[model samples]
Target: MTDDARARGLTRMQEVYGWKPPEIDGAFFATTVDHLFAEIWSRPGLSDRDRRLLLLGALTAQGRMETAEIQIHGALHNKEMSEEQLREIALFLCHYVGWPNGTRLDTAISTVTARVRDGGEPRMRRLK
Candidate 1:
C-alpha cells in the first residue's frame, strides 16, 4: 500500500471535488495531495468503484462538474466502470442533491463519454 492511498488530513480533503487552492504552496500542496490520495484513499474500507461513486456524489452535491470529471475518469480507469454507472450516479444525485446539479453532472458525463466514444481525450482529462 502506498502513502497515496492513506487518509491523512490534506489527503482526505483532496479526495473531495474542487478542493484545489487558488495558489500552490509547496508544503500545503504536497500535504493535501498526499492526504487525499494516500491517507484517506489508502483505506480499504471503500472499494475503488465505491470511491468513484462517492466522488460522483460529492461532485454532484457540490455542483462542481469541472473537477468531478477527473474523478470520473479515475473511476473509470481504476475500476473499469462503464458509462452507465456514471450516468446512474448523476441521476441519483439529482434526487438527493438537486435537479440543476444533476444536469451539470449529466452534461459533464455525457461530454466525456462522447469524446471517449470518438476516441478523443475527454475534455476534463489533462494531457501528459
Candidate 2:
C-alpha cells in the first residue's frame, strides 16, 4: 500500500479505536491499516455510521464485548449514534438475537456510556 493510504488509515483507526499496534507487529498492522481501513472502509456504499452500526451488531451477536466496547465508544465519540439510539438498538435486537446476547450487549453499552458520562477517557489497550 502507498504511504499516504497507510497513514490515512492509521489516523482513522486511531480516531476510532484509540490505539494502534506496536512496531513489533508492524507488518500485520500495516496490512490492516492499508487494506481494511483504507480500501474497504473507504468504500462509499455505507456511511461511517452505518458501518459502525453493522459492526456493533456483529460484535454483540458474537459476544465480543471488549472489541464492541471500543466500537461503541467510537460511535458516541463521532456522534454517529446517540445514547437513545444505542439503547433502542439493544432493545430491538433482544427478540431476534435472543435475551442472553442482548443482555450482554446492553451491559457493554451501559459500561461504556457510564464511562463517557463520567468524563473518563476511552479505555485503550493492545489488540490480541
Candidate 3:
C-alpha cells in the first residue's frame, strides 16, 4: 500500500527468507509483501524461527513440497535449523501428516540441505 509498508515488507522478507525477493507487480504479490510480510510476519510475540516451524508443518501437511523446499532453505540459510532437525521434523510429522506427505517433505529437506551445504544460492520463484 504505502512505501513504508513495502520497505518493511522487503526487509522482513530478507529477515524471514534470508534473501531479497524481486520486486514484482500483481495483487497477490502486493498482498504478500504489503500485508503478509509487513503486517503478519512482522508482528510481535512470535519469533521468526517459531513462525518458520509452523509454516513448515503446514506446508508439509498440505503436501506442498515445492514451497516446503523453499522454507527448508530459509531455515538452513538463516541458521534456525540444522539438517538433523529438519530430518527429525520430517520423521516426527510422518504419523500425523501421513507417510506420503512426510516422504515428500523429507525429499524437499534433502534437496535444500544438499544445495545449501554445497554453497549454492537459494532458488527464487518468479512471482506473477
Candidate 4:
C-alpha cells in the first residue's frame, strides 16, 4: 500500500479506537492498516455509518462479540448509530441470525450503551 493510504488508515483506526498497534506485531498491524482500512474500507459505495452497521450485524451473526464490541463502540463514538438503532438491529436479526446470537449481541450492546451513558470509556480501548 502507498504511504499515504497507510497513514490515512492508521489515522482512521486511531480515531475510531483511540489506540495504536503494538510494535511487536508490526506486520499484522500494517496489513490491517494498509489492506483492511485503506483498501477495503476506503471503497466508495458504502458510507462509514453503513459499514459500521453492516459490521455490527455480521459480527453479531458470527458470534464475535469481542470484535463486535469494538465496532459497536466505534459506531456510537462516531455518532453513526444510536442505542435504539442497535437495539432495533438486534431485534431484527433475531429472525435471520437466530435468537441466541441476537441475544448475545443485545447483551453486549446493553453493556456498551450503559458505559456510554454513564460517561465511561469504551472497552475497545482496553482490548488487546
Candidate 5:
C-alpha cells in the first residue's frame, strides 16, 4: 500500500474511532488501514455517524457485541451519539435482529457509556 493511504487511514482512524491504533504487522491490519479506513470509511457519501450506525447493526446481527462495544465507545467519546439515542437504537433493533442480540447491544451500550463517562480507556486498548 502507498504511504499516503496508510497516513490517511491513520488520520481517518482517529477521526472516526477517537484513537490511534498501535503499529501492527499482518495482512489483515494492512487491509484494514489501507482499504477499510482509507477508502471505505473516508468515502464521501456517508458521514461517519451513518457508517457507525450501519456497523452497529451488522455487528449486533452477527452477535458481535464485543466488537460493537468499540463502536459504542467511540460514538459516546466523540459525541456522535448520546446514551439515550443508543438505547433507542437498541430498542428499535430488537424487533429486527432478535431480542437476544438487542439485549446484548443494550448491555454493551451500558458498559461502554459508563466507561466513557468514568474516563476509562477504551476496552480495545485494554485488550491489547
Candidate 6:
C-alpha cells in the first residue's frame, strides 16, 4: 500500500475496529493489497468469470462471508456470472466443503436477490 492506502485503511480501521488494527500482518499487507491484487486483479486480461471463481474459492476457503457476498454482487455488476452460476458454485461447495459453507452462499445470494428486489438496480441480461 502507498501512503494513501495505509492512511485510508488506518482511518477505516479506526472507524470499524476501534483502531485495534486488522488481524492481518502489516508488513506484507501493503504489498499484497497495493501490488498483487490492485495491480494484477484489475487487469483486463482476466474475465469476470475468472475473477468471480477466484473470489468464490478464496473467500470460501478463508471463511470470509461478507467479502464473498460483495464479490457475488460485484460479479453481477461486472456482467461476469449469472445468478445460476453463483448458486451452482455454492452448491458444489456445499457437497465438497460442507453444509455450513453452502449456507453461506445461500445467505449471500439471498442478500443480493433482496437488494435487487428492493430496487437496487437490475442488471441481469437474458442470454439470447
Ranking by TM-score: 3, 5, 2, 4, 1, 6
lDDT string for model 3 (8-95, tens) is 9989988888887888989899889999999999999999889989998999999998888888999998899999999999999999
Q: Candidate 4: TM-score?
A: 0.84
Estimate the overall C-alpha local distance difference test score of candidate 4: 0.79
Query: Tens digits of per-residue lDDT for model 2 on 58-92?
Result: 88788888878888888888888888889888888
lDDT of 3: 0.90
Model 4, 1-128: lDDT tens digits are 68898888877776655456444335766788878887778789998888887888898889988888777877888888888898889999888889999999999999888887898766643222
For candidate 6, the 10 contiguous residues with the lowest summed lDDT are: 12-21
Which lDDT values do the candidates have, in the order given?
A: 0.65, 0.80, 0.90, 0.79, 0.89, 0.64
Once model 3 is optimally superposed onto the true structure by TM-score, how far is the C-alpha of residue 115 displaced, in angstroms?
A: 0.8
Angstrom error of the Cα, residue 54, model 5: value is 0.7
- Candidate 5 lDDT, tens digit per residue, 37-102? 999998899888899999999999999988899899889878889999999999999999999999
Better of 2 and 4 by TM-score: 2
TM-score, one value per model: 0.69, 0.86, 0.96, 0.84, 0.94, 0.61
Best by lDDT: 3
Number of clashes recorded per candidate: 13, 0, 0, 0, 0, 1
lDDT of 6: 0.64
* Regions more than 4 Å wrong, model 2: 15-24
Residue pair clashes in candidate 6: 1-30
Candidate 6 lDDT, 27-105, residue by residue in tens? 6666644554455554678765676687787787667787676667666665567788888888888876687877788
For model 3, the superposed segments whose C-alpha errors exceed 4 Å read none
Clashes of 6: 1
Predicted candidate 1 versus true structure: per-residue lDDT over 1-128, tens digit per residue:
34433235444544433243233446545654566555666677877667777777887899888778777655554445788878887888889999999989988888767766686643433312
Residue 31, model 3, lDDT:
88
Better of 1 and 6 by lDDT: 1
Ranking by lDDT: 3, 5, 2, 4, 1, 6
